[model samples]
Target: MADGTTDQGPVTMLATPISLDFEFTPGVAQSKFLRGLERGEFLGQRCGTCGQVYVPSRGTCPTDGVATTEDVVLGNSGTVTTYCVVNVPFAGQAIEIPYICAQILLDGANLSFMGLLQEIPTDQIRMGMRVEAVWVDEAELIPSLASVKYFRPNGEPDADYDTYKEYL
Candidate 1:
């Protein structure tokens, strides 16, 4: 009151509760890719102009902005372009502590995709390491990348950087 003003000691605010529900559908390009995963197939779409193949195709070429139409079936094997060892623990992680998360480029595809790297010691994993997909039991599979449980060492020599350097 000395400054001719009164101040409130504190203010209480109320928060409204919210409830929500959602359903989703993967569009045309991704739908086809997911369907292929259901049967352990690595399907990619090819851009007619640039001849670049894209796995989990978005139905368009990022390089040329052309519609990708040709269906290309890539092998399960690929090269690990890069990776990181995840030693930190987080809730809801299905794998054990200290696993690898990597970007793998399938043999015929131009882009790399992120996936779990398993079945080998983290110390043994490296760039250009060859790997192959390991699948879940057929009975347990759905149209998703989850069907490919993880990537494992393919017992092949590591690829030269020249083979996958562009992807890095």
Candidate 2:
């Protein structure tokens, strides 16, 4: 038997840093979504079986667990189903604190996605508010949602809660 002691023998410890370099394909649905973003478009996928549409398309029907095949183009304007006022700061966040992160239900789509809300007073922001995508210049368009700088009030009336209650 060995007693619990650190004086038994000399021990050596080594530490090292490692970096990762990898590449992958975004798959069929994601690739189509990214391609649409590059052209300043919103492409959603439709579940063949359930007929549910997903924005930034998940490539599958979450409810039915079936692969989405049909591609649907969505409108830039949408309704804010819900939102939060960000009062705390976190690492790697580019915008100033006290901003609104809203879940928007784009027109013609069945799902809602989160995006930064801008050009609107935080105190005035509310659920069911109408907003539209503010896109960057064509020259700056990339294969990413970054092309859509942010969503802002579209000068439309706020929708009733009942209109978007399912998303919330």
Candidate 3:
């Protein structure tokens, strides 16, 4: 037995352990995309039936319900379909708070990827704003989306809301 101020058994407290060793084996589609990233290219797979393009490539097309094999290079520039200001900090977020995160539909690609918006104020970020990828330094190329530093405004006029509204 133990008094109120002392413990007779092991004392336990709630704690979460954090670590950084993360590794994975890529599937067929992801393996191809990773190879492309190593070569400094963006790879996409086109749906055989619907002809829709999926960037970062997929093993199968969701629309046509079939495997896609046609690999294409998505353009570096795209239009921001929608966005949000991430004022709240989150785990594993590389950038600071009050940054704009956006969904961009690259030219000639049907699917869009969510990425961080940079080189502009969060207040200036709007739907349909033209943007382009900012590649990471040449020495830092890797098999991941992190290869692209971020997307920034390209000084082009904003697109019509209706033009990309459905993408949202």
Candidate 4:
């Protein structure tokens, strides 16, 4: 232990840092979803059996284990199902601390997607808040979630809690 305290005797520990580089192949569902992001749009997979939609789907629905072959285009705006204010720092984190990370339930989608919420103070962020995607510049569009810079309030009325209670 770093502090050198143990019940029976002193314990020795080794610290190791290992890094590996590997290529990733996206599955059918992920390929489609990434393509939509490049076009500055949101895409989700619709499960045939459970009829639930998932963002960045795993090519199948976890609920029914059914192939989610249907592609559903989702609206950029959605309701904030829940959120947390991050105050701790970690490795490879680009955003500053004290930021809001939220689970947003996009319109027409059955699942919530995680995104960074900004343009509002942490104390002001609330559940059922209406928000919209803030995409990167057109030239920076890519096949990744990073294409959307962050989410922000859309100036609409707060959503009724009933609309997003299931997600919370």
RMSD of each: 7.4, 7.5, 4.3, 6.6
Q: Each candidate's TM vs. the true structure?
A: 0.86, 0.84, 0.83, 0.86
Tens digit of lDDT per residue, candidate 1, span 29-98?
8999998999888999999999989998999999899889899999999999999999998866888879
Per-candidate total of colliding backbone pairs = 0, 0, 0, 0
The lDDT values for all models are 0.91, 0.91, 0.85, 0.92
Model 2 lDDT, residue 15, Cα: 57
Candidate 2, poorest ten consecutive residues by summed lDDT = 8-17
The best-first sequence of candidates by TM-score reads: 4, 1, 2, 3
Off by over 4 Å in 1: 1-20
Mark the 10 consecutive residues where model 4 has the least summed lDDT: 2-11
lDDT for each residue of candidate 3 in 64-137, tens digit (9 for 90 to 100): 78999888887888899988998998878878889998999988888888988999998888889999988888
- lDDT tens digits, residue span 6-68, model 4: 565744776687999999999778989999999999999899888898987879989897888
Q: For model 1, what is the error of residue 79's alpha carbon versus the real structure, in angstroms, after optimal superposition? A: 0.2
Q: For candidate 2, what is the lDDT? A: 0.91
Task: Give lDDT tens digits, candidate 2, residues 40-78.
Answer: 999999899888789888688889998898999999999
